[model samples]
Target: MKNTLLIIFVLFIAAQIIQTPRDNPLSDPQKEIQAPKEVHAVLKKACYDCHSNQVQYPWYANVAPVSWMISRHVDTARQWVNFSVWEDYTQEEKEKKLKEIFRAAYAAMPLSSYMAMHEKANITMEERKLIRDWTGVRK
Candidate 1:
């Protein structure tokens, strides 16, 4: 049993050495999404971490398996829509992303796991309406 525990500890330590890459490239503010201050506040609170080029990784994100999951989620979210580079997208792309954002605002976003750790990021119904209304996309 002692040997097994020792092995597990060693494996856990070894896992930390294999750091997952979590990159948030330098973003141009001019390229970021333009929205009313209220809308931007909601986005900054609930969406930017995963959806934009402004991920605020938590301390656990530097640990092993959790880091891998966080990195992958951020990468996938950026692929869907990196609001930090909003102006870089074509108009059509922006429209599509806005539509997606409109849908996501209802309940599918600010992922549950994320909200579990970030209480401040939990979007209220009013905030959801704000995001959807800001997107200018209908259901």
Candidate 2:
């Protein structure tokens, strides 16, 4: 048991040396997505952390395995829809992103795991409706 514990501890320490990128690049406000204040508020609370270039990394995000996981998730989220560069997207891309946003919100995103850590990021029904209305998604 002692040997196994030592090996596990060594592995964890080694993992810590693996760097995870947690950059939040500067975004031009003038080129950002335009939306109503309420809509923006909801998105900021529930979506921006992963989907934008303005992620507010929590303390846990500085730890090893968690940091790696967060970095991967943020990368994936930004790839799917980066609101920080919304104005740069083509009209078709904008439409696709809008549809994705509505669908994700309807499915209770911020993701349940994310909401578990960030209670404020939990999407309410009204907030979801607001997003849907803004995106012009009927369902």
Candidate 3:
């Protein structure tokens, strides 16, 4: 039992040394997607953390296992729709991303796990409507 506990402690400490890539690539503000203040606010609050180059890392994000998971999630989310580089996308890509944004906002955006920590990121009905309206996605 003592040896097992010691190993576990050592493993935890070692894991902390593993570096996780949490890059926020440079993005041009002028080229960013334009939206109303309300719409942008909602997106910034709910989606930016994972889907943009403006991720705000909370303290826990620096922790080993958690950092790894957060890095992977952010990477995947950015691959799908990175708002920071919105102007770089083609028209078809923009349309697809808009549809996806509307769908995610109405269905499962600001994922429950994220909301657990960032209560403000929880999208209300009004915010959902704003996102839908901005995306021009009808119910």
| TM-score of every candidate relative to the true structure | 0.94, 0.97, 0.95
Q: Rank the candidates by lDDT, best first.
A: 2, 3, 1
Roughly what TM-score does model 3 have, to 2 decimal places?
0.95
Instruction: List the lowest-lDDT window of 10 residues for candidate 2.
Output: 107-116
Error of 2 at 57 (Å): 0.6
Q: For residues 1-139, could you state the per-residue lDDT of candidate 3 as single tens digits?
A: 9999999999989999997988889999976888899999988989999999999989998988999989998999999999899999999999999999999998888778888899988899988998898999998
Ranking by TM-score: 2, 3, 1
Q: Which digits, one per residue and each the tens of the lDDT, describe model 2 over residues 1-139?
A: 9999999999999999998999998989876788999999998988899999999999999889999989999999999988899998999999998999999999858877888899999888999999999999896
Candidate 3 segments exceeding 4 Å error: none
**In candidate 2, which residue pairs clash?**
none
Of candidate 3, the 10-residue stretch with the lowest lDDT total is: 26-35
**Candidate 2: segments with Cα more than 4 A from true spot:** none
- lDDT string for model 1 (1-139, tens) is 9999999999999999999998889999999999999999999999999999889999999999899999999999999999899999999998998898988888498898888999999889898888878888666
Model 1 misplaced regions, further than 4 Å = none
